[model samples]
Target: MSTVHIKPVPVTPEEVIAVARDHARVVIDAEAREAMAASRAIVDAIEREGRPVYGVSTGFGALANTFVEPERRAELQHALIRSHAAGVGDPMPEEVVRAMMLLRVRSLAMGRSGVRPEIAEGLAALLNADITPWVPRHGSLGASGDLAPLAHCAMVLLGEGWVREADGSRVDAGPVLERAGLRPITLSSKEGLALINGTDGMLGMLILAVADLRHLLTMADVCAALSNEAMLGSDRPFQPELHEIRPQPGQAKSAANIHKLLQDSEVMDSHRNDLAHAVQDAYSMRCAPQVAGAARDVLAYAETVADQELRSVVDNPVVLPDGRVESTGNFHGAPLGYAADFLGIAATDVGSISERRVDRLLDITRNRGLPAFLSPDPGVNSGLMIAQYTAAGIVAENRRLSAPASVDSVPTSGMQEDHVSMGWAAACKLRTIIDNLGTLLAVEMLAATQGLQLRLPLIPSPAARAATAAVGPIAGKPGPDQFLAPVIEQVKRLIESPALRHEIEEAAGPLA
Candidate 1:
């Protein structure tokens, strides 16, 4: 496995995706270590001077007015970790936890969090050793920095929580740390607050969601093209000249992609000059680029937000190089919340449009000359009729999930922390929407391919042919339906597979 080196500078969303989803190893750079040391020196001076600092010498949130003696400061740090590790529900996925850890490390590496280099090194060791902490899925208000979830992560570093082994078994972190030749170090002044106070959790999930949505958006264009060809729809709407008039970058790109996919299509050529065909097709076939392209543009905006977030330092009472420690609101997750909610809305619309295309492929009247439901005997086999229902159900769920989580806020910490951002909620629901969209697109792919197969002697474009061939290995040619649930799942797998998209792109050239 390749390793991703973390420096003091900001990382790109693509780098986050590589480390989070690809399980890449992590190493902190020398510049980051130097920055961390410089920051820690400021914190040490504050502690020595016995001045009251929010997280260094004083208490936190509602308890900020309380003072702590130097002798018991370490105990304060330990208690903070124990009390805040109060998250509930099922543990988060391992990938999410790992991403959270990496982002936390990156934030501390900025040298603004007043954390020691050893602390950052310990996190890197945990990633390198594959010892994942069990972080719960709930209890984050996305203010004061995903406190509960990150505290659970810090618990593992303190040798007090569970760690997941490579085989997926949970064990005491103490023993695992010992086995890895690692020892849990005591937290110094502000170290505990620094560990738990950041937007890493929401940010990590947002980055991963952006990567998935990007791929799915491109695949949507391919599915739309396949549906256009299978339904004998004209490629005239996708011509560059037609799209240039409107000039939406994403819309133009989508039209270009569809045009390429339908290039050299015998099925389209066969009906090119037929005046008997309707002058225009239905909205589902004719306006696919406009709908899907709008979603693509929304995703582009979300990606921009993720990129800016990656470079930010998100912690409270951040240590400064000029030797001043000041409190700030960088930890608030509203930015991430808005981005996740926007993507959710986009995913819902994209899935909804894809479902409509699937419906068109099944209706005999609308599917042009294709058989009813694309089944040899429509009444007996039922064909893909229920698959559309499944897609519809998922699209409906996505719509509900698309409600903006940022708008809903509840006060926390004795009202000391009020107006919290539900960014974490937005991020979690966006993951579900992305998964649902993938399955919905998969159903469209199956129906579109079946429609193309029924066209018989008249072949689809090279791109559509490649798409159908990719599915052929996983889902056989159209006929009387067998156990369709498995076929839908198999085709879903193919739709999500990079190989399928690679094949289509190879035949049709690069898609936008």
Candidate 2:
């Protein structure tokens, strides 16, 4: 198995993606172990002194004032895990659970959580052994550090929950741990709290979402360029000189990408001297850079936030080297919530614009001289007309999903936690929006490629030709309209395929 070294420092989203999606083995750094041991000494000392140190000795949230005796401290930790592992609904994808576990291990390795090094190592062992705990999709409020969801993950370490086996069946984790030469960890002072009290769940989703959006956004540019070429749109608006006056970095990059994709096109050349063509194109074609570029900029800001969160130790009652355990609100999910909400809005707009381009391709009156719906035989076959409807339905749903969940706060835990970030909700909805965007872009690719092929003798640019060829194998050529649902799925896979993107880039260089 390939391995990833986890240290007491921030890791990039790419690293998180590798572990979460690619099943990389994890090994904690020696320095991180030393740091964890040092912090554990402080927690042990506090336990010996019999001083109530929040999570170390006392009950949590509304019960913080209730102190437990040292003899029952271990029970407190176990009870905390059992109670907080109250997540409901279907289990989250194994990849998402692995990400949450990895992030929790990374935060604990920072040594500020006062967890024993064994606790961190146990989490790493689970990842290395490919033992994914059954974490439910709903539970976290995005405040109090994704407590419920993380607790479900922590339950597996204590040999108390279900784990996914190699064959994808859920089985008892205790047997799995024993078979892997791992023993269930015994919780010590603050160890259970350390395991569960962090922003690992939301942060994990945010990091993964960022990685997905990065690829999809770049692919969006490629799809837009193809649509623009098929629609016979002018490239004059994408000139570098025209973009420099406005000077949005993402905008300039997006326009440059479109300009490069349209370079040396026979289709474009065919219309270069045609004065009868409209001087400009519709907003969807002409403003592709402006809209997609704005999304690129939003993603950059979100990446910055994810980077900062990666470095943070977001636990309550964080241990310090000077022996002070201070309770702070560092675990609040507001920052991540705002970023997720903004990204959803951006994704919705990107999908919305792509739907517009798909719409233009289907309308006989609006599609220049192309046949109705890009069908080889109009009226007799619906062609891509319903595909446009599907895309529009998803686009409409995205607009509803893009409503910011962060703005609303609900009180919980006897109102001790009066305000919650709801960042988890935002992150979940953003994921849906990103998926819907891919489908929407796929519809545009299907229609645009068909429209370009219908243009015939006048071939598209090298980049467009490459993109069309990449998707052709999956979507096939436009003919008597067969069942399109399967074809749309195939095209969506192509849109998300890195190999297809690479093929296009080989012809047009890198996109924005």
Candidate 2 lDDT:
0.88
Candidate maximizing lDDT: 1
What TM-score quantifies how close candidate 2 is to the native fold? 0.98
RMSD of 1: 1.2
Task: Report the error of model 2 at residue 1, Å.
Answer: 10
lDDT digits (tens) for residues 1-512 of candidate 2: 36778888876677788899999889999999999999989999998888889998899999989888888889999999999999888778887888999999899989898988999999998898888998878888988889888998899999988887657677888888888898888898788888888888888888888888888988888888888888888888999999999989888888899899999899888887898989988999999999999999999999999999999999988999999999999999999999999999998999999999999988988888888889889889988989999998999899999989999899999999999999988988988899899899899999989889988889799988987887788777888988889888998988887988889889988776
What local lDDT score does residue 339 receive in model 1, on the 0 to 100 scale? 91
Against the true structure, candidate 1 reaches a TM-score of 0.98
RMSD in angstroms, all models?
1.2, 1.2
Give the range where candidate 2 is weakest over 10 consecutive residues by summed lDDT. 164-173
Tell how far residue 156 is off in model 1, in angstroms.
0.5
- How does each model score on lDDT? 0.89, 0.88
Regions of model 1 farther than 4 Å from truth: none
